[model samples]
Target chain A: MALRRTCLAAAVLLALPAVPAAALPPGDAQRGQAIYERCQACHSLARNRSGPRHCGLLGREAASVAGFSYSRALRESGIVWTAASLDRFLANPFKAVPGTRMGYAGVKDPQERADLIAFLAAAGPCPE
Target chain B: MRDTITSLPRRSFLTAGARSTLSAGAVLLLAGCGGNKAAMAAAPEDDINILNAALGAEQEAIAAYQLGAESGLLTKPVLDLAVQFQGHHKEHAEVLAKTVRDLGGAAVEPLARYDFPSGDLKSEADVLRFAAGLEKGAVSAYLGAVPLFAERELAKAAASILGDEAMHWAVLRGALGENPVPVAFVS
Candidate 1:
């Protein structure tokens, strides 16, 4: 009886559901990676991050890029960095936040959008 | 100076008229060639084709922007950013069209409608997710095409637009509180 109970408990513990890896919120990372290529012309993934770095971008202050001359709108938007907000801005810069220095059209595909966001989220400054 | 009235022969007058006509014809011909030269240079066969692709991409971008703006989930600042992008797309399209015309080529009409990505877009979060992916696609497409452009002017223009695209991506990522840099370009 004791052996049976121990075996049953172990089985139950093993059957617990595993947490899902950071699922993409909406955008597709593969496509987002490609779309992000255009950005590589002006930014770097490391260091001072000219124009802006893709690494650790989410949740950062809009005016945080040390050497970049950010537009007044982005600098003053007073919006906290978050995945949701980032999606809005990416979808349509003018629609999400007018007068922002960054000018680009929004993404069209929903899944790709989620994937991109998720990728960024996963790559974000590893939760401090 | 003796006042001798020497009436030039009719032949001289006729010859002068012929010379004037010939000069006028030459001027017109040269003008035509000049115009053609400019047109030809603007849209050499390769440039015309490349500009069309760029314009097409811009149109696609515009359509995407319209969809995102309609969602009403974005803030005012974001709205402005989108508008700027829309404007740039429009300008890009116009420039490309002009180049084509200068090159004696027909401008390709933009797509009447575009197919956006679908699925699970039930809320504001859904919309943002969609936007992110779309932006990535645009960026990637442009990057791939950049290497193929021959004119330095076109390349520079594309590069400038691309720089802004990166900024837009970073801003969006920043808003999401995600990492701005997706991949390091450095080896």
Candidate 2:
């Protein structure tokens, strides 16, 4: 019980507002910029439009968006987005983080995913 | 909640009144001790009932995958994936059972035989479709329980499980010639 309590506390603290991080190969900012349009519906770099803001996604912990009422699952998931992790997650959001609430289906094409990841990675730190 | 399991086929293996006595003992212990009220509320009859129901559903899911694997309908890649999915269900089952125990509640035990209502497994498509249906059911069950857990932390656990169930549902749906990520939000 003590161990469980400590773990839960750690999870809660990690879920608090933090930075974002990701890893990806050098990508075509122009192509990635175009591909990123698909994610505009729910995600915006400036605000929590529909999903959490992607302003400073790189170097941040998963589900750490302050003031956003994230699904309990996403908040509790011990994940930090990186190129590799985000690649797997973006390929299948439900698979990467089963309880996450990012409603987008995911970019199936490898090139498309890479381009998008690159753009998001370089998008810079978010401030919502 | 043990009472609810009476109708479940797996309960037959246990001696009659065993669950009843177990529940009764747990209740007495809880009633006598000055336990945490919030915890007790978190494990209320309805919540435990939902947990048991989820447990039963997951148990059924594991069985379905096992049965599918044994049917010899899948090839190399398909067979490997089927086993991987089965492992997922097993993990879900373990977490669920541990949650039940943590809540000081009774859980459904694995039975010798589970009668999957979905009829005969004739072809590969039939097996995939059957497994898909079960995953869908899991999504439904866990999603429904997310709001029912009185304890906030338990709700988080339920939500986590619910997400995985939704993934399974979506992935399996895609395997059957359907768009994998068909929807954004799955209720």
Candidate 3:
């Protein structure tokens, strides 16, 4: 009877949406770390290296990344870089910004994109 | 259905039917050779499609090159640029053919006859106009295919090649005393 009750409780939780860690896999934070290397070319996690210092990029306004020459189209357009928006843009930059200079065609795999997103989420928002 | 006919063995009947079927198969195989020969003579199917588009672009370029070569509109320096442009197109076809082969695909041979613009051949201006149109079409075709390719490397390679085509357009347009970028952005 106790086991049955436990199974029933698990099922109910699984059926719900917007559970913080429920939908996400226990992603290898290490793999996510490695994948961030590729992104480092155009983005910087420590300090603004090539384009923008992406340390606390999450929850930040897309237009406000400092010292980067963002396309005028992107700067004027009010798109914020939340987890969802970042994933969509990483899938295809051209689709996200039709005429912007980010020429990457995007990583196609969902899990990889997810892992990368998770890494960015962990990176936290940039220091004000 | 006579009982006397049933006395003959099933084995003989099966053997006779098999022999007749085999003969019929052999006859059909011989008749199908014409298409097979043509297939052998021409390129493999996949490469043919890629090159058919490529060949059309190269032919247009050749026409423009010849015009640029013959016209006295430009000095030696500009004429040299025209020659280099023509050479690249010729080499592009060769390299693309090799790429198809490296990927285990066949390369297409050019067709015997092609119909190009016959309306005007009188002046340098007419030739430049034709060249510009050809370059525009080639750029369009290359850029159009970039999104269609699914493979990661192939998509990047297509984009890289498309960039060259764009440069060619810019160069040719400049040669004709037109702006390299008449329009600001290409989406």
State the local distance difference test value for candidate 3: 0.54
Give the local distance difference test score of model 2.
0.61
Docking tier of model 2: it is incorrect
lDDT at residue B45 of model 2 (Cα atoms): 54
Estimate every model's Cα lDDT from 0 to 1. 0.53, 0.61, 0.54
Higher-TM-score candidate of 1 and 2: 2
Looking at model 3, residue A26 earns an lDDT score of: 48
In candidate 3, which residue ranges exceed 4 Å CA deviation? A1-128, B1-48, B70-75
Q: Candidate 1 or 2, higher lDDT? A: 2
TM-score of chain A of each: 0.64, 0.76, 0.71
> Which pairs clash in model 3?
A44-A54, A56-A125, A56-A126
Whichever of 1 and 2 has more DockQ, that candidate is 1
Top candidate (lDDT):
2
How high is the TM-score of chain A in model 2?
0.76
What shift in Å separates residue B35 of candidate 3 from its native position after superposition?
A: 35
Off by over 4 Å in 1: A1-128, B1-43, B118-120
Name the weakest run of 10 consecutive residues (lDDT summed) in model 3 chain B.
Answer: B26-35
TM agreement with the true structure for every prediction:
0.44, 0.46, 0.41
Sort all candidates by lDDT, best to worst. Answer: 2, 3, 1
Task: Indicate the DockQ of the complex predicted as candidate 3.
Answer: 0.01
